[model samples]
Target chain A: MPAVIPTDSVGLVHPQTVDFPEPLTLECGRSLPGYTLAYETYGTLNAARSNAILVCHALSGDHHAAGYHSVDDRKPGWWETMIGPGKPIDSNRFFIVCSNFIGSCRGSTGPASIDPATGEPWGLNFPMVTVRDWVRTQAALADRLGIAQWAAVVGGSLGGMQVLEWAMLYPERLRHAVVIAAAPRLTAQNIAFNEVCRQAIMTDPDFHEGRYYAHGTKPRRGLALARMIGHITYLSDDAMRAKFGRDTRNGKAFSFGFDVDFEVESYLRYQGSRFVEQFDANSYLYITKALDYFDPAAAYGGDLAAAFAPIRASVLVISFSTDWRFSPERSREIVQALYRAGREVAYAEIEAAHGHDSFLLPVPQYLAVMSAYLERIAQESGR
Target chain B: MPAVIPTDSVGLVHPQTVDFPEPLTLECGRSLPGYTLAYETYGTLNAARSNAILVCHALSGDHHAAGYHSVDDRKPGWWETMIGPGKPIDSNRFFIVCSNFIGSCRGSTGPASIDPATGEPWGLNFPMVTVRDWVRTQAALADRLGIAQWAAVVGGSLGGMQVLEWAMLYPERLRHAVVIAAAPRLTAQNIAFNEVCRQAIMTDPDFHEGRYYAHGTKPRRGLALARMIGHITYLSDDAMRAKFGRDTRNGKAFSFGFDVDFEVESYLRYQGSRFVEQFDANSYLYITKALDYFDPAAAYGGDLAAAFAPIRASVLVISFSTDWRFSPERSREIVQALYRAGREVAYAEIEAAHGHDSFLLPVPQYLAVMSAYLERIAQESGR
Candidate 1:
């Protein structure tokens, strides 16, 4: 048997932990205990604690928002392109706090976390979580850090869902809210994508109904497959075409068979395969479901206006025109809802071909928008 | 062990084989004797042979074009919507010949087919095939059926690739060509999508370098994931939103964990799960490669006009306006090529929100345009 060469390189890059005890009541009526959040902090909190910014991570995001890790040579994290020392979310100016969400596998209390009672990983036993639950956990973390208020609460996509939740659940905690490429509710299309991914993870024979760890057979293939599908949605067709055309592999004519005929095939394969090294399939199911169940408007009698009624924070909603997953129309829905609530809101649907990932990419226009918004927020807060 | 549930009752329908062999030589300098083809004939062949129309199937399509078996309630076939007694192809007037392509799993000489020497499934040892191979095989079948000429060859998407190939490879045999939602060459974007799907299939742990049959694991999850990805491309974002738009199954509330949340997710899951039962993963890889490698213009030099130089058939090129996979621009390229070839060509880029699958839907404009084109072909053939 070939020795299983562990790509231990993954997850070793950053080590973070946040310990909380006992059961945390989730909005869905489920109770989760031993709630420990793994996170990373960059820059420094100021004396007034007003410069603290809560940066929410997306579906597959993590705590290493910027800067190099001592354990690994790889760059800071997945959003390294947009969240560095002098980047838009400038680590130099603000104390950026990013925590791995409750259901994430990155050292968070997720499906792979050990269950105290059973001495086994939680697997499907972990209580179902909502966007509100994730936001509440962040609040607990914030209170522990002596940050009574935030300069801004910002996120994109699923992270954007969290940002919206923060505004509704803890309006007094944030002076400004930046929701990028996110929606107040998961459109049926969003849910559909999530459902397919969950099904992909669960249907794998190795999934073993979420108990595959004991058998030493991880549902890596399923996780990878789900990631590949998600990757497609994250990119625009134009970008895919421009990046990897129909060029055949190996400087040889196409074998006319299924031999990884194009460069794109190899790239996706690498992405999917590498993802499974650190991600848990069951966590994929949990997080995707959390994203699907997020609907701030539902709590306010289907009136998004009512949901934002309590918010006093200045809102900055940024959407990418080409983001099909969470389109500009969805952002517009948020803008209209804020308007109805009489809340101070600013919205911009930027034109970009990068699709949903525009927020993470260093597109000059997106950076410019965020930089301006941050500058205005700082000025308004007297920072 | 859980028993493998066959998909959608289609597997219960017994298929008939059509033996077609010739001295086959490939562009890769490989030769094989006795290539067997499997096909199904619908409608009766008229005495004059002018009523014969060849129907080319898509990537995973088989010979069963229309009508369910009485014993099994499976939907007739994927293309059942467009081919029936009085439908667009008009079985009553035109004898329809639908063949399982050369590298397809449906009773064709593909990875799942038997090798006469070993008396076992060829598996990965199956020869790599091209669009030209499938076209040549169809041509051989026509010859055996005494179809000296076809009134028209019709197909959509990958099927359209075959239609174009028929017109190019043996123009004398075709009187009319109908290509729908297809391109002359596989753009980088098309290759990228297909490549990801191939990666998903190949990376399945059970895939075992394409020898999973012995392990009783068929890379079903991977193939299903691939289909899930492909299904997204087949529909426009607007269509997905309109059709599913966050509609949930079981209940209206979000599960707040990993599960199907929206109507679209459920639909995509259904598509992916249902696909794996009838389709082979290896076949998916081979067929997609063929599509990715299909560049008719490149075959006849960079000029598409030259590719159509030898094509004498009158062409009816159809495109769906919302089809991002094969956009209207691609159809225009074909029209321009045919016009430059001095061939009688009619073009229509239909306004439909259903994306590439619009051709198979009941779009009145699409139906009307195709109906008119068929009428013209029928008239020209002295029907």
Candidate 2:
């Protein structure tokens, strides 16, 4: 077994890949023959190895959760504001592990990965994965690091879904679980948005039935459209109004042409264009499917409380006021279920203006509440 | 001048096309060399021509506001629910005129129409139009029909914008104005949604710079995607949840493939596919641009009250409870402005689950309110 490697860099983290020799059985009843998980670690594991904290990433997130991948990188990790030496998670006190999920394009075995059987990209051939599958894979990674139990598991959005799964499936493995801006299951409207995005990509001529890798072409236009749609949903109406208003680009009147006129339009276009460079279309399809298929209550005979009955970990669920995508009401559903199951759960519906993307933003109240919650967990675990 | 042709068949309307040989100048300072307006009229015009009411249609709506074009037609006119004999806008008591806007595809001079100069479709060459421009054209049509003034000008959504414009631009021409599910200006969020829809169509390779007609192909996929996005926004979250609550298609579990599994997805796909057959892509681009550019308050330096100051017509503004697209608050902006202008305005926020489309649906309360208001207008005008 490879020993856990500790990094000395203050605000930088490096990803390491670990290969699992055993074939992993997926929820769809398919097996992936030997897979590798790409992960990054911050700080050092204590002598007792109980100070480890696993961090889960959202749909477009990756292993770099807290630090700069390169010194000259234009932007830090997606959640840099909440991680690092003195941040809320406090890397100086607790060891942090963030991994790129199996179906992601960022240094993971996903649709972009080559299939040894056909000597081509997996694409649509990749097995469908569930939140439980991701949690189980994370558990295996934790075991390999010689951690008997993690002090806490924390995540937001899809990452938060993984946190909920970890609490339910491996109750004794973690002492605390934090789920933020997540839902028990996607609503019909949520699924509708995801389907439209899938349609956008699938209908693109360049997609080539997900075999675009073989043709050396990508569905950039379709992927950009999907990203633009997502960007609109991620922003609250108030936030958009405050940021862009009816402000025109370049302070000009309407050109009366098909040019980008409003600042919001230009911003969305940039978001769509920039996203295509970093994301894979097929990976997007797979992950969104995983999100849509996640219905914890379904496995428990439509009883959400029953699903949380076995959860032994102390749970913290956080939601934003303006997150219409996964509204605060959705968070209340999870919190109420935990309460109904006789579990210790803490929930905070933070007032925010950034909508679903608020979890990744640095809101002062949100940061303070997160810090307090982590402190309580640290005190309870005697870390 | 053509005589006012009244059809003897009840609940039936035949569209009449009138060509204007002279150039009609647009708000953007560009002129269409020659244009034709396609319109349909129901009921009989009184000897005084004072009972004539103009019914404006929203985006994707046509001149067929009541009755079927043919007996075998599968669907009645878009607003047939509210505009037939003995109905709310009662064709039995009022003369209703509905015309396809100049930028629409249904028998109107639009991007799909041929440009005599080029001997091809106008495509992107169609001049941009505003709500004010549409009202001016309608005024010209009324002149040609020997109807000096309208009894009431009624509309919903984008049509409502035109109704408001009529009250301000030609207050003496219309006695009553009914604005439903409309805003004084497009919000940043509204513009953002429109921008995404436009991007979806424009980015399509088949779009060919909006000249897809010349290329012997249409941007069906892109247009479909745009329509799907629009469909989502048009329906409220509660409406979607009630209609399709994660109900899978074909009574099967997850398909584990990209095929439509959720009923909502299937419905959106159907809407997208069906819209492509009846709608033109360049016309979509032009109309959405017009919608985004519509800001009645902008011309008055953001003083909505000032915009309504010259309005002599009595105003009725209606909003729906679950309409997130044009929220009740947006409707309130128009009503409050009318109040500040000391205009006779009646406001009603109907409890509806249909979102923006509630105005067109046969909601009992909506119908009752509309019927009573029109009765008051009729009594006042003594028609």
Predicted complexes: DockQ each: 0.44, 0.83
Q: Encode model 2's per-residue lDDT on A1-383: one tens digit a residue.
A: 01321242236567899999799998889989878899999988878787889999999999988666665666777888888776789888888999888989998789999988999999999888878888888999998998778899999999999999999899999999999999999998899899889999999999999999989999999899889888888889999999999999988988888898899999999999999999999999999999999999987887999999999998999999999999999999999999999999999999999999999999999999999998876666556
Q: List pairs with backbone clashes in candidate 2.
A: none
Q: What is the Cα-based lDDT of residue A354 in candidate 1? A: 81
- In angstroms, the error of model 1 at A68 is 1.9
lDDT of 2 at A348: 94
The DockQ-based CAPRI class assigned to model 2 is high
What's the CA error at residue B298 for candidate 1, in Å?
A: 3.2
Candidate closest to the true structure, highest DockQ = 2
Each candidate structure's TM-score, on Cα atoms with residue i matched to residue i, is 0.89, 0.97
lDDT (10s digit) by residue, model 1, range A1-383: 01331222122234578799967888878788668898888766777777888889898888776655654454446666666555676666777888888878888888888888899988998888878898999999998889999999988888888888898888898989999999887766566666666766787778898999877888776787778767877877767667775666665666555656677777777888899997888888878777777777775668999988989888999999778778899899999999999999998888888888788887888889888887776666555
lDDT of 1 at A336: 96
Candidate 1 wrongly placed segments (more than 4 Å)? A1-16, A84-86, B1-17, B42-48, B67-81, B84-86, B203-217, B252-269, B300-303, B339-343
Worst 10 residues of 1 chain A by lDDT: A1-10
Ten residues in sequence with the least summed lDDT for candidate 2 chain B: B1-10
